[model samples]
Target: MNGGLIMKEVTNSDPFTIVGTEQYNMVSKMNREYRIFVSKPSEKPPASGYPVIYLLDGNSIFGTVVEAIRIQSKRPEKTGIVPAIVVGIGYPTEAPFSPHRFYDYTMAQTDQEMPFKPDGKPWPKQGGASEFLSFIEEELKPKIHQTLKVDSNKQTIFGHSLGGLFVLYTLFTSPRSFQSYIAGSPSLHWNERNILAKERSFMARLEREAIHAKLLIGIGELEKEHKSNIGELAKKMSERLSFYKNRGLNVKFIQFEDECHTSVLPPLINKSLRFSLHSQVDQ
Candidate 1:
């Protein structure tokens, strides 16, 4: 043993900070632990309560989303956007991502969608979007409600790529869970486009009951050639979503010409915030 060596636990501080931010840990029913970061508005909440945005992939982009909210939302009069709370949901890991995302974000795989490993290794087990949605709706939301005054009717959720795929899954399976859903470059080819089946089911349900939600879908133009399958998938999703416009839904599709999959995220966050809060202010 080395002499004069004192070993003690090191207390690490969060690298990202937003005013009025709070951090917590939650364990889901599936036995997965999550890292949750939340930031409420600096100003007093409106009579309607603070709108909340639930974001996936929070491990990597929480700071950027929170920062954007802080800069533009500080003065809503100037920005035409209202102040709201941001809730980032991430996994408890040092890395920016986890392979758990593959299972958590994707639904059941079909025979045609059987994943082939790069080295011809065994395929990874997948399909947990349903249970993950339950964790959000049943456990996570209630926990947040206990701490903050949330306008439940104005809730929104945002995700990108695989997480984006989960957002679409959530909207189709439980349309009333949130007021707005934003998917940025969703992996529409997931499970061999099984989400299309979910879409048909969603439509059937909509026939019996009314649905009220706003959906904003955006993709990076450069991703077309880079993600060849996405071109067809996005087109299909666009067409399917368009059918719901007259059935009490607001749908918008945008392509960010200059941005690629990686670079398009900031604009997606900014645009989602505006889409959720701007029109509400005017109304």
Candidate 2:
């Protein structure tokens, strides 16, 4: 949050920009250069410092999240949204999303585990999720902490699609890394639904020690209708929600009406922000 961004003018020649947000490039230990975006609230930080939300697909949604936080957090009493730092991790690409996400957002899978592409094409190079998580925990986070005051106990991570799958992976394997998670339309069916196996281990860990973390899962109602291969995402996700609830995890599940995969992102991003930051506003 301490990264300084030169405020650029919003004009025909200059193009528009998010005023309070900063963007920088950092290379991971894996030698992957990522474009990092940070947006800090104008108000002073609370005694416990500001809650932080790390977002996947930074190039696509960084401004949306920044403006939502800027507008809604101004009146916490009415909005129930608190001032928080937003960090978006993405790639240095002119396009909205980089193709490299397939690797960064998915678990390692054997050739047999991966389903063939519908177009009869070979899959992109993938299965670098472990390294991606390492980059976040070991490299990116430490740099952010050094730059700003963040509430370690209130850290939240959010993702959608394959990124959502990574969110679940982080929760199951490294539950203590974040205090809350928001997974929107996760690709649970990936890798032959291997995430189900990870859930079992996560439950076992929870039974042995108390790890209080909040999870919110949201899926558009028409997801199944839009994508044939997904095969009843709402039903599958609901089952997972039940499993987490039975294990005594704090969780929330929502199915947005008439929304499909692409159309659901904006509302899901807004809902995720409120879900993660609302309760902490009064505290």
Instruction: For model 1, give the RMSD to the true fold.
Output: 6.3
On a 0 to 100 scale, what is the lDDT of residue 93 in model 1?
Answer: 85
Which ten contiguous residues of candidate 2 have the minimum total lDDT?
Answer: 226-235
TM-score of 1: 0.89
lDDT of 1 by residue, 30-76 (tens): 89889998988788888878989998987888888878888898788
In angstroms, give how far residue 149 of model 2 lies from its true place: 0.9
TM-score of each predicted structure versus truth: 0.89, 0.89
| Model 1 error, position 273 (Å) | 1.0
**Compared with the true structure, what per-residue lDDT tens digits does model 2 show for residues 1-283?**
2368777676666668787789999998789999999998888999998999999999988888889999999898888889999999999997888989999988777535565789988778878889999999999999999998899988999998888889988998998899889888888777545677777788788778777788877888788675444436635655665565545567777778889876788888888887889764111
lDDT value, residue 147 of candidate 2 = 90
